[model samples]
Target chain A: MNVFVIGLGLIGGSMALDIKTSNKEANIVGFDANEAHMEEAVSIGFIDRKGTLEDAKEADVVIVSIPVNVSLEVIPKVLDIVKDDTLVFDVGSTKANICTALENHPKRRNFLAAHPIAGTEFSGPKAAIRGLYTGKTNIVCEVEKTAFKLQERGFKIFNDLGMRIRYMDPKAHDKHIAYVSHLSHISSFMLGKTVIEKEKNERDIFDMAGSGFESTVRLAKSSPAMWSPIFEQNKENVIETLEEYIANLQKFKELMQQDDYNAIYKEMADTNRIKEILKGISIKTS
Target chain B: MNVFVIGLGLIGGSMALDIKTSNKEANIVGFDANEAHMEEAVSIGFIDRKGTLEDAKEADVVIVSIPVNVSLEVIPKVLDIVKDDTLVFDVGSTKANICTALENHPKRRNFLAAHPIAGTEFSGPKAAIRGLYTGKTNIVCEVEKTAFKLQERGFKIFNDLGMRIRYMDPKAHDKHIAYVSHLSHISSFMLGKTVIEKEKNERDIFDMAGSGFESTVRLAKSSPAMWSPIFEQNKENVIETLEEYIANLQKFKELMQQDDYNAIYKEMADTNRIKEILKGISIKTS
Candidate 1:
């Protein structure tokens, strides 16, 4: 199969690597708005060659793995140019906006909207690594809207990549992703900001911070070029999660003010359930 | 050296493991206020044998690695009982309060106040792992207060464990640790509490959260029994850092409320300096 991948950043570049691994004959072509990223992907052997919009349109399969807002503009164009037999899909984080943009498109049936629940804080073609998608969840929203043949091909591709397939409504995907994914990044961003702003000695924070701080602040290193627009496109749900987060922080702060060690202990102990939750997460991801 | 380790949890047990590896002839005896923790340490080979208060006073070296608040009560007693030849030290997070407790004690010269800037979110004897302290920073607080001979031995032991040592005053250690270490834990804990409270489906959160969420919320899995008292013992500094953290959250929230994507982008980009800072950190620790 000849596949053309748009936006050869972390996700697209990673999937390109996996696709080549799964099927040796799969020819993967990469394209990115940042020509440098596309060149890096090819030079690093993440893809067979670089391609154009026309090249993508004519390929056996087209996968758009660009940022969410970029997807709104580019995915529909890809759909317009795609051949009758082409299988198209996107691996965007937010789903509703892109799904809405394509609702009435004549080739809507050729496109599958997916959110692969896999990524790291790092970004760009340089951040690509092998086995990024294996055993992770692949969420396909509005699956029924995509043509039956497209859906079957999409499922087969994801399964070949060793991804667990899940079907969900577009709105539910956005709402849940806001809580599970976007909010975590925002929380980490704020944490890094607060520390950098408050701690006069950056060297000290670095020296004294343990692996726990490293883990908690890791997401702060994510690409702003990538994320700011995500929060913008998914404004309603992201803000709601942020507000709930602030409320919780305030409550915890009040408990600190009251010197309520008992309540603080109970709250933290309750949250330790995340240990079990993360254990479950690692098993699935592992 | 016959070393008596009080409070055989993560730090103590880990240090004991390194002590054994570094000096096979060194007899590492364990004593914990928690009898089960003591038994578990011995059973798991974290120590040579369980010991009593007499054994601690008789040992050539004594290490206290209990929770911060308990250290206040136990440390002074250990100081009172230490023989003139015993070199005693602590691995508590907060140093000021413990230093204050030892200020007028006659055995102060024998006690070196230390905080090994190393730990994971998990706790207990089971959490002890070999090489846990390797390539990590060990902050020696009020080094001048320890007898010259004891200070040299303390630095030598930490060096033998593959740790880089830094010296600072007790007050500064507490204040800086509040921002770098304690505050990170609170941010993570509140994040977990907020998600656990707001997101209705625990299973869904577990299923959907990516490695980013796992990293950001990892500290929420830490033992409250360990942290709440660190917050209490260093109440003033912890509260100040928390206030600054809250203020940062509010500023970010206001930006989101105004839909200021530009400011959001700039703020996160600024905080992304943490990437370089963490790079420097790994270089120092590695």
Candidate 2:
């Protein structure tokens, strides 16, 4: 298979690497508008060659893994250029916008809207790793809209990559992801911003940061390019989640201010049920 | 030297294991209010034997690694029971309350206030591991109030365990930690709560929980017994930090609702400075 992946950053570069590693017959090519990333991806052996959208005509599969905003603009362009047999898919976090953008395209049948629910805070080609999607969930929206053959090809690829597939409507995918994914990035980024603003001394942040701060603020390091459009695309859901999150924090703050230790304990204890919830979904670390 | 650890959970048990591994001459004893933890600590060889408050007086060093509220209640009692020359210290996250509680104790000079800024999300004796505090910062607050000889001993033990020590006033420690440490926990817990409330389906959460969610929500699993008092002790500071955090989130939400993509992008881009701030902290992980 000849695979051409756009935006050779963390997710796309990782997919290319994993595909090549797992399938010896696969010929993986990459492209990035950022020259440094393209060079790094090539040097790191993440791809066999640098390619352009023109090359999509020859590729068996074309992946749009750029930021959501860019993907909305780029997906139709790729669909217009790629061969009818080419299975074009996007691994974007927000689905409704991307799906909406290509809904009227003549080659829409060739496009599969997918979100591989796997990523790290780190970005760029250097952050790419093999098996990033392994054992992770991949949400595919409006699969029936894609040609049956193309949907089958996507299934084969995700299965080969060791990911479980879940089907959801594009609207539901956007709403649920806003709460589970997009809101997390915003909370972490804002937390990092608040702390940095209040504590001007970077040394103090570094010295006093325990595992708690590191864990909670880890998403603050995510690419702004990738996340900004997600919040914009899913603005309503993001706003709802943010309001609830703020309200929750305010409630806890009020409890603390009143010295209602018992209430604070009860609130935290209630939320601690997340241990079981997370364990239910958690990938085995061992 | 004989070392008695008052609490046999993750921190105390891990410390006992590290001390035993590092100092072959140190005989370690542990006691916990929870019998199950005490048994697991002994079974895991975190302690050579189960000891009591009476044994605290016989030890050359006494480590009180309990919940913050329990630490406040127990430190004075432990100080009253320990030998005049015994170096007593509690490794709680908050320092001001514990330090103040023991301020007038007859053995106050023997009690050293320390907060070792290291931990994983896992808790209890089963979570114990060797070298948990290795190369981590051990912040010693109000050390001038400690006897010079006991302070010398406390510094020696931490140094031998591969920890760096920094001194600050207890009040300053509480305020700084509220921002860097306590606030992170509340943010994570609320993040978990918000997501769980939105996505009632635990399977979706597990499927969609990328590394970003895992990192941001990691501290949600922390013990309520442990965190409740830290919030109670540092109530004012925590409330102030939460207000700032909620305000930041609200502002970002407004931008998102207004569809101000550029402002959203700029906000996240500015907060990306946390990448540089985190660099200065001693994160053992790459």
Candidate 3:
């Protein structure tokens, strides 16, 4: 079984590691634009060898895990070279554009649009770890477009990697992801910016910051290289979530200004139900 | 050592647990407006017994850990009854209001204004855990107002509990805390509100939510009873931080609307410095 992993970063490297673990005969080939990352992935023993896009021709499976913008240009070319019977998938955050771009492709049946929603604030080949997808949700968009045999192949890999699968249309995936994922990144970035601006004047302000502040601002440390494209691809939905978030913040400030402690207290108390809503979901924080 | 813990919640109860661990001769007398909490604290072995306000006369140390509004009312009476040798301190989030309210009290020398920057999202006696303050910063405000002997006594307890002490003025503490602590709470609460509102129209929104969203919204689970008073007392500084935060959000939204991906990328890349700022600080997520 020949598996070619493009963009040997967190997601791709991790997927290769897990696939190697599950299938003893699997040969993992890594291709990253960064020469250092491909070398690191091989040195780290996650990838069996470093290969070029030309090597993807013989692959039984090819996984594309680059930034969304780069994936837009690279995935169609990957599809252009892979065998008819080969299973190919791209694990990018935004799926609508890639799915729409590949709608009329000759090998469309061989391609699957998947988003394994699992990651840390860190990135790169060294950031990859085994079992990264375990117990995480993998939203597969436009599954109907993929061939039945390839869908089975993708599900086999997802199951072996210990991920729960949810299917949705590509457009709906982008809209919903804006609320749950993209908006949080924007919120964290702005919070970090606001505090950094104030920290210039007040040097010791961080001494007063507790675990709560740390938790709320953790996403501010995510890689801009991976996230900027996601926000761009999902601009309309991201903008909508940001507007709603800003309005909610303004309303809270108004309540405080009016000395309406009752409303302020009630607002937080209402949001406290998030504890119950988020109950079985465990977030790893190191 | 007759140590009276005036509230059997997360902070006070945890303090009692640690103090008793350090001082074998110490007797922890628990008191809470909630009778169930005092009883539970005693039964849980964090406190040796339940006590009333009259017991404060015999207290060698009084640790006040209640809502700031309640502390304003109860702390004065605790000082009036405590012995001249007793060390009385309140561990609330806001400092300036309580410090000013007791500025000219007859027994002001017996009081030390301190804010221990530690806690999880949970509350109550059941939420109490050992070593909650270990390796955490304890900001002591208005230390000069307290008697030199009482300040030494307070420092001894902080040292025994493995806490790092930093002296700060009450007004400065409040203002800085608004940026690092209060503002983050407002952001988390508003994020949770925005998502919950959207969840009304889209039921499966949270299904796509990952660890990033979970971490960013964790503070929304905090107790409103405790936070409302902190925000009210620190209103002016809190309002300032909110305005700055809202402006930053608006600016980010404008950049998105203008389709300036370069600026968006730079904004997040700049804020990634938070990883360095928070390197040695560990926040307990579970």
Predicted structure with the largest DockQ when compared to the true one: 1
The CAPRI class of candidate 2 is: medium
User: Which is better, 1 or 3, measured by lDDT?
Assistant: 3
Docking outcome class, model 3: medium
Q: Write the per-residue lDDT of candidate 2 for residues A102-175, one digit (tens) a residue.
A: 88899999999999988888899999998898888899999889999989888888888888888999998888
Q: Summarize candidate 1's per-residue lDDT along B42-69 as a digit string, tens digits.
A: 8999798988877877788999998888
Clashing pairs counted in every model: 0, 0, 0
Model 1 TM-score, 2 decimals: 0.97
Kindly list the per-residue Cα lDDT of model 3 for residues A1-286, writing each as its tens digit: 8899999988998898899899989988989999999889999999999999897899989999999999998888889999998999999999899999999989899999999989988899999999888989999998988999999998999999999999999999999999888999999999999999988887867767778888899999999999999999999999999999999999999999999999999999999988976774664211
**Colliding residue pairs in candidate 1:** none
Where does model 1 exceed 4 Å of error?
Answer: A200-203, B201-203
- CA lDDT of A285 in candidate 2? 20
Query: TM-scores of the first chain across all predictions?
Result: 0.97, 0.96, 0.97
Error of 2 at B172 (Å): 0.6
Which portion of correct inter-chain contacts appears in model 2? 0.81
Model 1: lDDT of residue A166: 84
TM-score of chain A of 3: 0.97
- B20-128 per-residue lDDT for model 3 (tens digits): 9999999889899999998899789999988998889999999999999999999999988889899999999999999999998999999999999889999999999
